[model samples]
Target: MEANLTPQQLWDCALRLLSRRDHSRRELAQKLRQRQFDPEWIEQALDRLEQQHWLADSRFAAVQVRQHVLKRHGPLRIRAELQRKGVGPAEIAQALAAEDPDWFELARLCYRARFGPDERLDMKERARRMRYLQARGFAPDHIRYALESADE
Candidate 1:
């Protein structure tokens, strides 16, 4: 169990996890905790990783934002996801800004992909599409634009 493991082993495990992919300190800590690593040891390992520039919330946020954007997820979903991952507000804002996705266009693309660009929807169907885009985390304005101009 944890008694048999040393701090060095925890550190190595942290590095091994990081070598596979970057992780936010909180995420990394949670992972270590799941393995029943000592809380103190986890803190020290996280501090060392931060000091060595190996684990960074900001970097994790950036990668997350890029990946979500590619999946056509909007700002609301992306921000919520970063928050869930324990990314700071400043880092989330910075990463979103860095990506600078054209949310309107992205919404339009999603809408077009779901319903053909030239297709006309009945009132109920239009409402349904609106809800779909809203659930996809688009802003009200962006969803409006997407519906109105998806064909154009």
Candidate 2:
């Protein structure tokens, strides 16, 4: 179906979509395409939103990182998710770097919460926990630290 939306209508639709959640430019473009918006109009609308500071990959990455961290997700998982959401590598790097110190701490807390006290995990259990944490995007160093400093 052809989209009969005027530029203003498309802009409004974009804003409403953004209001529900922050979207990367590519994501927004895809959404507009799904809605059958003209490709050129979609690009124009994206540009307008960016000029207005309504759509920013950096901001989206930051908010996504904050949410994932609060949800106890590891950096690897966060980075993967951001990439899936179409955030650029540079923005992802910047966002991840900004959370470097606290990222490990968050992973540690999540590990403890999921696996219980460190002493409770045996070698097999430790390996299992490590795998789980790694899948969640935690680094090996952080996993090792959590295992080593696990409360008995």
Top candidate on lDDT is: 1
Q: Which residue pairs in candidate 1 have backbone atoms (N, alpha carbon, C) closer than 3 angstroms, thus clashing?
A: none
lDDT of each: 0.91, 0.84
Tens digits of lDDT, candidate 2, 100-137: 64766777788878877645556787678889889888
Which ranges in model 1 have alpha carbons more than 4 Å from their true place?
Answer: none
TM-score (C-alpha) between model 2 and the true structure: 0.89
Worst 10 residues of 2 by lDDT: 117-126
lDDT of 1 by residue, 1-152 (tens): 55798898898899999999989888999999998889998998899889999999999999999999998989999999889989999999999999999999999999888888567668898899999998888999999999999646
Q: What are the TM-scores, per candidate, against the unseen true structure? A: 0.95, 0.89
- C-alpha root-mean-square deviation, candidate 2: 1.8
RMSD of 1: 1.2
